[model samples]
Target: MFSKEKIILAYTVEKCKKCNLERKRKYQEGDLLFAETSKCDSCDGIAVIEKIFGETIEK
Candidate 1:
């Protein structure tokens, strides 16, 4: 579980993007980016700002 301070990307369904997602994206408070909910993995992939790219970053 990541804290709000750790939030990097917020994932939501395409439709949700029209509302909640857009609101957060507009803020861009940090490394925030919005991805489709279906694409979400951990934490529903919501509010996940830190990308643990040690060995997970595979092109």
Candidate 2:
């Protein structure tokens, strides 16, 4: 029997892709930053210290 193999890749969180817009925004320890998504607006976002991505490969 062959079991399924789980694969995970490392990830990192940076500011929004836009500099002009990001300039006005700021990030604290718990500020959510939404990535560049077509469905999201300029403010559509999550915290910078996200729990899901907080457990990456320890950078």
lDDT of 2 at 41: 38
TM-scores, all candidates, are: 0.14, 0.25
lDDT of 2 by residue, 1-59 (tens): 87566555434344443332322332344444454422213565422322224322322
For residue 55, model 2's alpha carbon misses the true position, in angstroms, by 10
Q: Which ten residues in a row have the lowest lDDT in candidate 1?
A: 50-59
Native-referenced Cα lDDT, model 1: 0.30
